[model samples]
Target: MKKIIMAILLLPIFLNFSGCTKKTNEIPKTSTKIEKSAIEDKKSKVNIILFYPSKEGSSLSASSRLVSFNNSLERTILEEFLKGTDTKDTLYIIPKGTKLLSVSRKEDTIILDLSKEFNDISTENEAVLNNTIYSIVNSLTEIPGIKNVIIRVEGKVPKINNISFENPFKRNRSIFNRDKTSKPNDILKKQMEFESQGRWLDAYLLYSDDENNTYRKYFDDYVKENEEAFAQGFISKNFTVGSYTVDNTGTHALVKVKFNDTNRELNIGMIKIEESWMVDWIPPQ
Candidate 1:
């Protein structure tokens, strides 16, 4: 009878050990699922458009920035646009004390009611007036369902200089920056544009073969090793193209860039390869 009781007590211990062993083997599978979920979450991102004054202060340019997916995407985009660019390379055209009163959607249009402070912008500078209007308009129109933007100040349609706010404002791509007969300058502009938006691969592809340039030979490896620094370096440096000189052959060019972060200027070298102008070397940070 004692042996029978002993067997009954040991049975529970044996079953418990087996169950623990099974779970131990399953742990790796559970961890893998969690890792995959994290990767999927990272892959899911949304793009938001932001308008900022050009580095050369010519006009406003639109930059695409990524953010985590959210239900209130419009509201989130508006908030981020209002906050302005972190790098300060571009000017925040919005007036101070401005608030987003309300956002209403109708069909394919979005109506934004802004606070009275928005009307306080000076109309003397027509460029400023135009930029201010479309900065808000252009930024909001980037949202999927918003084809047009209607703006109101304190619930009343206000006039910004000569332009009327009564009608819905469509996107004005012409107002954005454009190339002006300087193809090499345009290439440099694109390089900075991609870098600003954290599109490293797009930016890296602009480089050309230079045996002396480490960035060309080990470009991918260098970016992988210094991913964080590479991103920070590009985003933080607001480069203003100062002066550009092209060789008589049109194959070699030296472009000077002024940085907001440093007093020193950066001289970037470019070479025309075949029919395209490519960056010869990565600019020193």
Candidate 2:
């Protein structure tokens, strides 16, 4: 009878130990569903994004084709301004001439590294250059969050045909789309019709002042000076240019651009300056 009593007491202790062990071992399971949920939560926070802007001028068609969304127009504007060419027919190959070498995105700008063949492929013909310009800008500008595009070739900076590539324009870059506030300078604007058509060398001379803009003295002398009138007339914030062709002599162009606030359109023309690349627009302050 005493042995039976001892056995009953040991049984209660064993049951208590077993219950404690089961409680200590239990844990919540984290499976694929939980992990996926965490990842999705992280992705939801990254909605705002900026795109690349162009230093090379491209064509309107090129800009339009850069992206599908409407907000991407900023990116296209920068690109077309820099590239100064149209790239519509190159659908047989890649959309933008040679394939892009590399594309890096910064806060408000995009740095694009071009393939080696960029210089050799389109170097000879002005039409090719225009096509190239239009294609690159039109394509990239359609993406939102991109404001600037700095183009390089084979990991090196390519020189502008006539002018320096060093300057980036805030005035030009700041405004996009057609501005309702803009007007026209009927006489000067009409004189500059060809500049928008991609006459690069002629466009450059129209703006370039000899040695520190000594040419500005002639701004007072409006009759003989075509470029000064064009510069003086630029008063609006917005700008837009349509598609066109270029005649290539590998020479830099003198550009006379008149912004007609009354007409709300830019009048562009070109005269031969020298052999060099023509940058489309300088940023306004």
Candidate 3:
């Protein structure tokens, strides 16, 4: 009878210990839900520019693309840009075989290391060439805080057929749609046409005083020295006007031109002296 009484007293104490152990081992359901909610909130949506050929096939036009934010935002945009678009009407700017090897960022600038297939772009189509470059530039610059882009191929700055890709490019919104009444555009078009038709003197007449004197002396020396390449360097098979930016004061401007024989843009600087807009002495500024 005494042993039975001791066993009954120990049973309540054993039940209390088992209940405490179960409570301590359980996880809070609220904490797990909070962690999962934080992970879902990290993802966001951003708008990026995608360039495609216009309806007439003459130039490239910008279109809006919605993308999910990722750690490598610029790379994600480029990969999507390379993939073209879902709609059948849009087109890819970079060549089909081209590959983006790597991308790195430093403050306001993004550096792109691309493969050799990028070098083989057909310059005969000037619009395609300019679009290929700006499609990358304008698209990447859309990301907040990124202002410029530098491109390299095969670990070296590209220099091909009188074109140099060594300069860093700024975002050009002017290329989206050209302004027909732009005086800078008219002057550049006339000058380029004159040169393409072998009218060197007519083309030189459109230059500012400094450019005229410099080119005159250059050609005179070239003629006397029997150096043909120096003079021939000014000539191009054809050119298409891409973009132009005029200062607020309306006296200075920068015009972008792409040549049929070269893959890079030629930025021509212009100044409005008195009444006429003339190509300045310094071509690229």
Candidate 3, residue 6: how far the Cα is off, in Å? 76
Q: Give the worst 10-residue stretch by lDDT in candidate 3.
A: 218-227
Candidate with maximal lDDT: 1
lDDT, candidate 1, residue 73? Answer: 61
Candidate 3: list runs displaced more than 4 Å.
Answer: 1-46, 55-58, 86-89, 160-163, 178-285
Ranking by TM-score: 1, 3, 2
lDDT of each: 0.63, 0.35, 0.62
CA displacement after TM-score superposition, residue 33 of candidate 1 (Å): 12
Give RMSD to native, each candidate. 18.6, 27.1, 28.3
Better TM-score candidate (2, 3): 3
* Steric collisions counted per model: 0, 72, 0
Segments in model 1 whose C-alpha atoms lie over 4 Å from true places: 1-45, 55-57, 68-70, 179-285
Worst 10-residue lDDT window for candidate 2 reads 46-55
TM of each candidate vs. truth = 0.48, 0.29, 0.46
> Model 3: what TM-score?
0.46
